[model samples]
Target: MKETFVILARHGATEWNRISRYQGHLDAPLSEEGLEQSRALAGALAALPIKAVYTSPLSRARICAEMVAAQHGLAVTSLPGLIEICHGEWEGMLLSEVEVRYADLIRQWRTYPYTVRMPKGESLVEVEERSWAALEFMAAAHPGEISLAVTHDTPIRTILRRILNLDQAVFWQIKLDNTGINVLGCRQGRWRVIALNDTCHLGGWLKAGEQMAL
Candidate 1:
């Protein structure tokens, strides 16, 4: 059977990302550095035989999706199911601030994320369900072809966790950098991960130490 290749990528960085703030459903634009990273990500995938491009409706993911789609002369199709997990009241707050304000929840989030839900937001189980359904739909729609989907950190991690059949507690262990690329192959609804968080495209930018915890 022919496999459908899906390139799952995390959107480029934002000021909130650099500051360790929760972005959730906020529509933050990419920083200058983020724009450069998106460009590099696009350049790296330019020669691939990509048939379509998809992205979260959020602007951050849209920026990267548009760049990569432009390279292939394709229009980006926004998928709400691929959006980031809503951090609800914690959307724009810093991690440190959240830690102080919601001490118990914050501690639970790091230690037992699967059991903790962000104040008014979502749970890991919720993200996994929607994101995995979205991925399944994408794979079914593009059989035997290659496609790309740009999304946020939580969606990537949750989807990868589900794909790899890993325990929910291991959620925080996945390290997906800004503009990180992941590849998966699917056939008849069976998925296999080919790569995870490949950031070699960013070159020297990886040394900038811009990555921070969510």
Candidate 2:
């Protein structure tokens, strides 16, 4: 069987991201520094033979997918299932604010994520289910080829946890940086992670102060 390579990337930084706010399903445009990060990511993947680019319907992820796909003369295909985990009531709130209002729940989320479902939001299990469906569809559609998927932190983390065969309670252990690249290979029905959260392409901007804590 031919091997398939999937490049998973989180969208670039946003104003909310800089302030440590929960974007969830909310939309936030990329900041000036974010535009640079997208460009750098585009350049980094320019040499690859990316057959398709998938993105969340949200602008933050769509923009980054566009930047990278444009380099290969490909159009980005929006996948709603790839959207960020809905934070619902916690949307737009800073981490500190969430800590104050939902302290116990927040602690549960940190310590036992699978047990703490966000108020009015989807759970990590939901994210994992939908995200895996989307990814499996993409992988099947583009066998033996390279493809890109631009998404958000939680969705990416959920997918990573599933791919690694880990429990959702350990979800926080995976850290994905903005515009970070993760490479996964699938061959003969087996999946292997080749790289995780690679930011070497954005060394210049990261050094210049576009660092993101999440």
Q: What's the count of clashing pairs in each model shown?
A: 0, 0
- Residue 12's C-alpha lDDT in candidate 2? 89
Model 2 over residues 51-161: C-alpha lDDT tens digits?
Answer: 999999999999999999999999999999899988878888888999899989888888898876788998888988899888888899999999999998887888778
CA lDDT for candidate 2: 0.87
* TM-score of predicted structure 2: 0.94
Q: Give the C-alpha miss distance for residue 51 in model 1, angstroms.
A: 0.6
lDDT of 2 at 2: 86
Worst 10 residues of 1 by lDDT: 204-213
* Total colliding residue pairs, candidate 1: 0
TM, every model? 0.96, 0.94
Q: Best by lDDT, which number? A: 1
How do the residues 1-214 of candidate 1 rate in per-residue lDDT, one tens digit apiece? 8999889999988888898988889898999988999999999999999998999999999998999999999999999989998888998889888888988988888878999888789988898899988888888888899989999888889888887998888878878888989999987777889988888888743554644444
Error of 2 at 189 (Å): 1.5
Give Cα-based local distance difference scores for all models: 0.88, 0.87
